[model samples]
Target: MVREHQYEAARFLWGEGAIERMGEVLAAAGVDRAMVVCGEHVGANEELMDSVENALGDRHVHTYTGARGDTPLGTVETGVETFEQHDADGLVSVGGGSASDTAKAISVFAAEEGRTLHEMKTQTTDDGESHIPDLPAPKTPVFAVSTTLSAAEVSNIFGVTDEKAGDKVVILDEKIRPRVCVYDPAATATTPASTIASTGMNALDHAVEILYSDGHAENPFYQATAEKAIDLLVTNLPAAVNDRDPEALAAAQLGAGLSGFGIVGGISINHGINHPLCARHPVSHGDGNSILLPHGIRFTYDAVPERMARLAGALGVEVEGGKATDEATLEAMCDVVRELQEEIGVPYRLRDVGVDRDDFEAMAEIAAHDSAMANNPKRVTASDIVALLEAAW
Candidate 1:
């Protein structure tokens, strides 16, 4: 068998006080004036914001607190306007996935003048093939300070919600990838425990989906990183989320960062389903991921049983005599995931997270068109998605 893969490497500064080096990182990236992008909650954290401001000092031009969950297109436009008005040469994205995504979208939208996000996004053909357009513009650099396990900073792709269409639009541009990433547990301490726990599941979903994704299944780099990510998250997430242990949180943060490496290899049905759920409804990305992960694993099992079974060891499942059938391993894996969710106190069902059963068909239809769905190991139809939603419900 022959396999080939490519990945982009970004400078990463991680540890207890990694964020203190923000000014130095910006200087190295040649960013003279920087804008801090964050959500209302993160922006309102006086201590955290003060630290960030103090670190950036004169380099910090403005703090945009309009970042919303789900990375709304409207918010991105507003952020782009703010970025231009402040004369910011770069962005420092603070908080979870939404803030990171918002900053990335702002960079692209700012660079690609006279174009809307809808015009720059991936489109589906009449025959159902995904067409991702080339974005050749040079985007403003982004320096990400991740505060959750969603790990959106490392990927070159970002999803923005088109409010009118009520669908998530994915845009891919290598230039929008963060120039540097800072992961400090101290920064995440201010985030809610439930948010941390749910996003940790979202990280786990990234690892699981990569291992079984048709495009990534044969890539050794993705396989190694994803396996290690799963191990670290499984071991540390409980302590990190429940007890708020800094050391444990740091370990989980590393897991989330490692999990992000596999994003270049591609994600599959899990994210395909999650994208629409978060876009059209009031669902958080992490909660949607948590609720859908087990069902996704089960759905892709038959197509990639060996790949799925390999996760047993990663999930800390023990076989009776060193070897068990894939079926047994599959059940054990799902059970372990459920137990982890329970220990972390995250919702386990779609209904528990305010997902309406009546919208399953519509969500499924939107999900079927997501680019990630094209990478599923098993062939997935909108009807299959509806059935999965029914089972999850």
Candidate 2:
């Protein structure tokens, strides 16, 4: 059995006033020439950036808001070249996962090194299976600013998109993790409600899947956090998406980060299966996870009924009286997902999101073969995944 080790430690901000700490870090790290990597659209928030600049005045901050959706390799490479041209000292990513992930790629590429990020482009599952990129030593610090509730900032991993292959791949390493995460609720307010809803579901699935993972028995601490994350999401997400209530936004940001920490500690199959849907259909990560959630939960329920019951209850689905049986409770979980989706403006079925049924088989083959499948809660076959895809379809 593999032993669990909680080896990540990164600073986080919950309520308001965290922006002060964000400034403190920028001054402390003294990032050579801090590049604020965000989406080009964010340029409209000049007042916000000016506010941050005032806070981080000590660091010679530069702006590089270009990459959106997927963290492109070309973007990262170009950004690295730009950073070098400007003699940038460090990175300050102020978007969602893509910008931060692109920063990680830049940090790796720009560090004082022999290998360059180019050498690390192709990775195998295992470190020994392939050569470790000629990584630079004591690489540049990467500070993150999250404008969304998706907790990718807290995890010691980066998700990148290979546009050439239309696939997402993760760069999981402690070094890639952020040095600090600045969470300003005001920042999230600028994000689209639909984006908020998508990431919320992804965060929700993270909480749900972790509670039932085979590794759950081994990592009790995170299980508690996962359950609490689910509870917070159930009560707070609708409000966050519906009204952008300040309190709700605060709760969601904190909950999503906590859940992210838990999920990274051990994600198992849901992520494994969800990756293909996102990769194959160009579906947004959060929406893809949301679309597959109930089905994924249902499939895993047979192996961990009690856990599913807890999830069902956490989702605010009453699992009482007639629902005492796992079957009823499990179905109720699906209802809860649908309710949440509708509440958050998500479509009831995959077709609404433009996922084609014709490609289900092909996606299933990739999903079943995905590396995450090896540690899934329930064993999965290509056919089983195809069936689940059909059900979600």
Candidate 3:
């Protein structure tokens, strides 16, 4: 277990109308000029943009509405150019994960002085050894106005895809975590139920994986937070998924933000494979996670059986305790995840969602060495990953 003593904390503002206090948050951070990074749909809404501009007062200098799912390398480069051209002192990420990730990519590149994005790309050897080039902390801070439950704003890691290589490179640094995270249910009102539900499952995956992660074995703080995150997501996600209730949206947002706390400690097998699936297919990150989560739990259950029992309980499964083997409780946990996936209208099998069977070998090969794989509760070989993918398929 690669345990560390690091504990990461972020400033979070949650409720309705959180965006109304944007100027106050920015001013407190000593930001003078800021640019908005968002998706086309959010950017095209002139009224909403005007409202945000008004909230920023004179600090809002430009809007770059180019962020897309997975934040491809070219998109990050384009956003960097916009940030420099506008002379923005900070960033207001106005959408979901992709937008926030794009802003983080811009912040990192901007801080590197003369280095190009390619020069800053994470280096991984043929033997699966990886190296992240050290760069200075970003002078410019990020203030996020989240529209989904993915909780991208709460973590410093960014996943940027290289389309040419068909791989997503992840970068990590504490400095890239948002200076302020604004979670207003009203902001999420425009999001589709499918998107909301998928991301909610993604949050649940984070909490579940953290519970069994060896890296977090000594950090009770992370375990406690992960437990609460699971409870909140399980209790509130149904309302958000079924009714689109604003109150539930707020709860899910808070839950996701809390679950994000685990990311600093680490996540295990589920996230390890999920990233590679997204990089290989045209799958959304959240969808990939939702589809693969149950299988991941099953794969690592024996490594952390007690935690898996607790997870089953958190998911509302009634498992017999005393004489029951860990296998029974673990199966119950997977059952609940599958039930939730169906309840939220997400695909459960790899083939059900159009994953190409021929590419399974290639994807498993990449996943076996993905950076997040380092933290899995049990070490996995490429052949092990292939078997898991086949089982899901």
The lDDT for every candidate, in the order shown, is 0.87, 0.72, 0.80
Candidate 2 regions exceeding 4 Å error are: 1-5, 109-137, 317-325
Candidate 1 — which pairs collide? Answer: none
Q: Which is better, 1 or 3, measured by TM-score?
A: 1
Question: Backbone clashes in each candidate structure, one number apiece?
Answer: 0, 2, 0
Residue-wise lDDT of candidate 1 within 123-167, one digit each (tens)?
Answer: 445464668888888899998999899989888888999878888
Summarize candidate 2's per-residue lDDT along 1-393 as a digit string, tens digits: 777566567877655666657667866666546777777866568766666666677675578876566576678778887777777777888777677778887777666445533345433243212223434356678888888767777776665566666555555556768889888876776788888888888888888878776646357687778888988887898999989888887888878887887655356566766666776676777888888888887777777666666666777777654223457677777887888888889655788888878987777766665545555567787788888888878
List TM-scores for all candidates, in order: 0.95, 0.87, 0.93
Q: Give the winner by lDDT: 1 or 3.
A: 1
Candidate rank order under TM-score: 1, 3, 2
**For model 3, how does the per-residue alpha-carbon lDDT over 24-138 read when each residue is reduced to its tens digit?**
9999889999999998988987766776888999999999999999898888888989999999999999988998999998898788768765566554344544566677654
Please, what's the RMSD in Å of model 3?
Answer: 2.6
The model with the greatest lDDT is 1
